[model samples]
Target: MKWLHQILFLLLLASAAASCKKFLNVEPADRTGSNSFWKTRQDVEAAVINCYGFLFQKFNDFNSPVIPAVGDMRCGGIGGSIASGQLGQGFYTLSQNDLSNTTNLGVPERYHLNDIDDWGPYFESIANCNITLAEIEKMTTLTDTEKKQYITEVKFVRAFTYFYICRLYGDVPFYTQPYDKTPRPRTSFITIFNTLIAELDAVKDDLPWTATNPSDLGVRACRGSVYTLIAQMNMWLAGFDKANQSKYWKDAAEKCVAVKNSGAFELLPIEETKRIFKGKTKESIFEFELNRNYGNTSLYVNLGQWMTHSPIVDYGGNSDLYFVRPLMERIYPPNLPDKRRDTWFYLPYSNNQTFMFLKQINVADPTGYWSFEDNLMVFRYADVLLLGAEALANLGSNNTEAISMLNTVRTRAGTPLFTAGAEDLKDAVFWERQKELIGEGHRWYDFVRTGRVTDPNQIITPMTQDQFDRGAWTWPIDAKARQNNPEIVLNLYWIR
Candidate 1:
């Protein structure tokens, strides 16, 4: 009954009018008349829920696994090859950074991920947040405290949406007002991030440190989530904005330290891998929910679809992909004692189909195709800890604190503690991130922001300096974007 109610609400949201003319081609409100809506608490709550629902649809687009294709495959996690069918072919195209030719890539069903180029989904989510923020003020039914909290939560969603799309497209039109039809050009991503950082800082404390209600735990925005977002944005700026790298690194480290000291999160034991990935545990800072029984299941959204097989998947086939053996060993050497190597992989160094990534293997029906039960983890505490370590290492003087943060995650993974000097600390943190956050979809972006995508020592598919400068890292903007707005410029790298 609860699931049915949720579905009904989502259907209502889907009924909002869509346009092909404007920058964001959708109405912000649900099907209900905006003039009469937001008069009651339930209406406000429903709109808030719709904001999250829009995000879920954006990430869980059934046509293609957008997140992994955008985030992980480009990192060469599939060893730049795969034995599986067309799916592997698709991932191979992504691995080689051959994104502009996705349409021509033979396996049209699996390889043509034009949706990744479309900014509509992200804008739809942003529009919802914008309207909610605009009209929530008119709600006399809710108290000031409640209004403040909801505003901050919606702001978090909007900020996160801008951050995500900016990373993908490099620069995007910034919008805040509801039902904004004005055509606008892409703003600098650095300026947008800086604006968002301050806006988040202003409203962060309004949200609770964590959700007290069990249902809201990781799905709702919290202070910890806000802090982590700020830290991540700062770390990203640290790499690209070299003039102020030290300030960005320091800010990132401080924000991460705040999250750690908040005592609201802790890393789960290495043995509780299932619990950790199942999501909404103490480890999760923020995640989008997906329950098998609740009629929410995403095959393309989970790594289990491509990484698990046989007894684990009840499919009489081998894994669709495996990490490159050299990269795997580079992160987890045979001589090293890493519980992640043992617990997360069947054969850490296997180049064949027997190599299975067990981190996301939680399936409800081994024999059925739609059984992936793990929620889409957007941020977890361990990822924040590692980002903190990376930021501190970049600061040059915080080597000792950086090692302390790195060791916290390592100690949980039963890996050897990092006892290295400042010179080696940054790569150590980077490798730890590769090992800790693999398949959860942070790999490719990490390489780009860290400026390690061109470092042959770090990346398997290093882009050249000229390629990097020419926007090889960004996804191509869909031609549809320029339909209504001549100001909309597509990523020229993909124009050929």
Candidate 2:
């Protein structure tokens, strides 16, 4: 139970921590904690699992590890009622682009990283990874093969941590050594990204295709997940790495090829979209597993019931906040009747025929008692294919091939095909991604990576192309992230 104790101690430390920046600087519970630990494979396994747990396992808290609200809430796909006087001001400020008034200070009600809700947990998870990697090598209970697998897996997690952090806050404090008490300087976004991609590339060969163990399927990194991340990391850079945009786009296209041919995953048909997040699907490349009988502290799985409710419906959904009717109609076009339109949501004729997310509902447990049992998808084949389509179109890899990939997802949805120039094909793919990945927590990053957010859209924040190009699209490094580390430099343009 030492690992459980470690888990408790880390959670308590995270909750008790004061500022976002300082939140990441986690210290061990006892002087002997690390030295006495990492002596066996179980120790290493437990440690790595805790890294995943602390983020994915959480209930109602401002800092819950479901994808940060600032990422999507600001971009669109939701309509929130004002929670309290000034409590929900930040979200409105973000949504309405009320840039002149800068008087908000919490995390959930206010979707800014300038608050600690997101920054702390991400860094803490990274800290867990640092500790696991630093000591797993010292264990004598495992074979050389085990050592190689464990190290490679944790490195993927670490790189993903940095990658996730960079997408939200731009640049952050980078650390590789765990339990190092020194206050490290915050690294720049560019350097952090370059380092992350380089690290993933270096560890690529070492990580396995899938867990050789039967219990680890779809959850662990396979060459599929590794290359998919490479494709995604490069895509993130394509928009921001101005000087090398072409090179990065090409890299994303080439990297995704391995996942495509790995024979490990396939796109699920629209009829099978219901099975996409059910855990252990051929469609899921990486996901966090949960079972209703067991507690994982994940509250996100309850979203489907909440996002679609009204007095007329019996599923207990919170219908007030949901896909704006006009926008849903605009993007999906009820006339098109795409499978995602027909299947992912329901039109409650009783509630003026409003749209509700029906994707995660367990019909057998209509009251939503088993809602938490669903898996949280991190990466899947649909996303990977879209990544390939986007990158290939951008770099001129082959418009014909890009269209084919784009059409694959379309074929599943029974939507139209792409027959346009490369640039047009790129736009077509972005539009497809928006429709397909909605509510899965990917839109905001897509907006940032592509540098465009329109009003009368889910992302009501009216940002100019200039503002986005200058990194104004990202959140501020809040007081917590800077409180203890004077070494931290703020992204000044974000300051009101």
Candidate 3:
């Protein structure tokens, strides 16, 4: 079955002639080539949906080891033990001098560098966007207004995919064109930021504030979603350039304000925010929707029992695959009247059993077995508010406004509001982000952006280059990709 899936995927990729084929006709019998796929509006739309299919494919399983490999979280199930220690040593053990190739041995985890096969999913999606854009440029079936909207949607998705890659690997090849004969070099951080900003600005006026129809599922990019991406990119850029930090922060702040002003989203009430782990709230701006009926079972087995279950589940017995780090647990506000902790984590009892399992992912099979649902949220309104606060505070314009934004999130979390002035407000916001976004794979990036790894209170311990060399801050490029494309550069930060 796995081989058949691979063969089908290859067939899908090999026939570039049918790249723009309509989703409604995406059956094996209708397996036309990519060249014939983008001639119609329906074809163009299907291409875009195919691009998004990568999100489902890559993140299909929790134990699939994509985000957890790079983030603060560690895995410790029967198969998790090998991967668990690597994340700890990579992120927590500071300094580049102490790590060696031998350090990562015995780890069963697939490093991003080692998993070149995964790269195609991202690039393949980008290819779909490129093909759609080309077809749209020559399209006469749609009105000018419709063309603008379609073009903007494709551009937003293209920018989004590239930006996602940038966050993981500081520099990646920027492929705007569908076909490039010459080898494209890795873009600089500044160039990537400028390009992303240009794309977002160009498309902002074209996208709708929200999708009103069911046919538009994943069709139109929302105003809040683009703003969130823009805000996040700006905040990231600010970290690399301190002298002009305010510009980036202000950019983030403005986009965040746009999201807030739209009133399309709001922080889930304290009780509801606690229910986030259970996947029951409307606070999510965008999440990868998964259903068992869709024939995608990767989420059920990969992230379901492995990440959320303790010894209680048959498949996850005696494994702490999804256990929270001791350092993270310590940072939770003590005596805070919040239910997020109770809802998000499974506090262990005297017999080492969990007191409560996360309810959002709770799924029951017909045979009386249970597992978690695979839907993982990539962006949420709660994150947007915090990003806005951080951007405002970093800009040095409105510390008061930043505090207000931060306070709104805190109040929703049932925690006390922040009272500190500008300097202390930064720490307060930082800690707040740490607490609010834990276990969602944001910590390492947070450390990198804020230079917090050196701060004792932030990381469990400072990491070394020796650790970095073992696929730490930057994920290693797949060795096969380097073999296939010699132009791709390995991360220099890890090179001793």
TM-score of each: 0.92, 0.82, 0.81
The TM-score between candidate 1 and the true structure equals 0.92
Q: Indicate whether candidate 1 or candidate 2 has the larger TM-score.
A: 1
Model 1: per-residue Cα lDDT over 1-496, one tens digit each: 1122233334435433332111111234446454555567766776676677777777766636777778888877475233446455656777788877756544447433767788876886776677678778777899999999989989999999998998899999888877676788989999999999999989989988899987777889999999999999998888789999999999999999899999999899988988887888899999987776555666767665667788887776667677878878787889988898899898768876778888887786788664687778999999999998888888878888889999999899887788874338878888899889988889999999988999888898899989999999998888888876788899999889
Query: Model 1 — which ten-residue stretch has the worst lDDT?
Result: 18-27
Superposed Cα deviation of residue 37, candidate 2 (Å): 3.1
Q: Write the per-residue lDDT of candidate 3 for residues 1-496, one digit (tens) a residue.
A: 1122234343444333233323212224354565555467665555555555543455553335455444443212112233455334433222222223423533334433234223555665565566567767887777787788778777777777777677666677676765433455677766887787877887787766666553343324666677777888888888877777888888889988888888777676655533454342446655554445543333232332444544435543443344434542455644565555665556522123233334344443323344444445567777888888888877668988888888888887777778874347777788787667765656667777776765555565455545433445554454444654567777655455
Measure candidate 1: CA RMSD.
5.4
Over the stretch 87-162, how does candidate 2's per-residue lDDT look in tens digits? 2545445554433334343325422323332376666667667767767777789898788777877787778778
The list of candidate 3 runs beyond 4 A from truth reads 1-29, 34-36, 61-63, 74-105, 108-118, 214-220, 273-282, 299-307, 310-319, 322-325, 348-360, 364-371, 421-423, 464-472, 493-496
Backbone clash total, candidate 1 = 0
